[model samples]
Target: MMTSRRDFLASAALLAAGLAVGPPLLAAPPKKYLGVQLYTVREAMEKDPAGTLARLASIGYNAVEGATYTGSQKFYGLTPSEFAALLKQNGLLMPSSHYRLGEEPTNGAPTLGTLLHGWDRAVDDAAAVGAKYMVCAYLAPAERGTLDHYKYVADQLNRAGERCQQAGLQLCYHNHDFEFVPQAGQRPFDLLLATDEKLVQLELDLYWATKAGQDPVALFRQHPGRFPLWHVKDMAKTPERAFTEVGNGVIDFKKIFAQAKQAGLHYFFVEQDTTPGSPFDSLTQSLAYIKKNLV
Candidate 1:
């Protein structure tokens, strides 16, 4: 009933050849979701939010991080729910948004949606807009200038973070070169990092970090798992250190992105403070670079 000895030998040889050819090829890893910070195209959003969203989606961005949520109680003049609907219509997700700490005082009444003012309401709006992380976007000149100021900001961030956690959202601090500047022999960025990890996370901006002469990977090693969000932009090679499209400048994003796990990176947004031409054009270049090399 079985094969003859010669046939058995032939089958054995075929099996050995199959083994030599190696095991079945493994499936390629799932593509990571990449997003863009709406601030990259602020003007367009201000003019027409829905149209801007559609254009971004067409350019291959699956997600967007909001940069305007204050003053109007709306996102780009649309209520949180409306903005969320527009995003969904455009086949995009809003995973994170930017808010200010409100360290500086207003003229008459307190501003709403700031970490110092109406933070709980801000959290509600963030949730309504489908954001999982709310970032303290920037620090004004008056808000900084001293290490003590940073400690105060850290305390406020902790309180804000607690409220965010209650609402099922994470709080993060977005940094700039100013934080890296030494204040009385201490860096504010380091001071801010001392905040409770459970309460506050960091949104590291690669461009600003490089501008301040710090290595992004080194920071990741020092504060492993503290960063969950990132502003992905690049610095021009010239002395001006101008904003440039991703991969069109000097930052080694490939190296930085390789350390995403250590950085606790969940989402990153492409941002350019200013662009030479249309911002959408800049975003297109950055998205292409990220898809081709980094993601």
Candidate 2:
């Protein structure tokens, strides 16, 4: 009935402390739901894309990045509509696709008319499958030799990105170790970043970036809000630097993820290029680690 001013002040102080710390103590970090690149399970997928997708869904994958359209589209085999229906039936979402840049038929190769023709079909199929990104997964061998070559690649990427913009999708470049090599006194990757930040966003493969002797965190700092996605795989302690599941290697994901907002991260996919055992086992272990440590 009678409360002293001193007691009220003490209670208020305690309340403030609890308000400041209680939520963090009780609540876990937000869940980073796991995604798998279909490429990791290429063997299984090649055998049965539909069946493999069903199994992946059952294994708790909510999203997928497409590696090929092997259903009925004749691009692979599946029509765009058929591919979309298959994914929908299996409770999966395709958010991105990896396409080769200069390998399309239209550039006067053997079979197809131009590389861009296949790319156009890819964009149409990706749109049909509701993908948000069209990714240039790798550069051609000819395109990889020089800085001038990379600049040309960047130019091509800008053009592709314009098409992607018209299709309401973003074009992204997935890095490998080669891009880190110095060219024209700068890393080709850096040139690409500078060439067109809007036209070519990044899907930084943490493992490859580290293998290339670059710091992922520094890149994030240098290009704040440019990376939209990340490949959250790990590297082994060996000289060959084999692929390992997430959190099993030395990369500090906790530190990298601390700048999630600055990195413009929308989603991160767990990709083990070569698994030591079953792909499912590797992915499950990786996802479990993320759930426990970095989520």
Error of 2 at 206 (Å): 0.4
lDDT tens readout by residue for model 2, 115-155: 24446766666787788877777765555777877777888
Global lDDT scores for all candidate models: 0.81, 0.70
RMSD (CA, Å), each prediction: 14.9, 13.7
Weakest ten-residue segment in model 2 by summed lDDT: 1-10
Q: Quote model 2's TM-score.
A: 0.83
Clash pairs of candidate 1?
A: none
lDDT (Cα, tens digit) per residue for candidate 1, span 89-136: 998888888887776666677667789888878999999888898888
Alpha-carbon shift of residue 202 in model 1 (angstroms): 0.4
> Model 2 off-target regions past 4 Å?
1-33, 69-76, 103-115
**Weakest 10 consecutive residues, lDDT, candidate 1?**
1-10
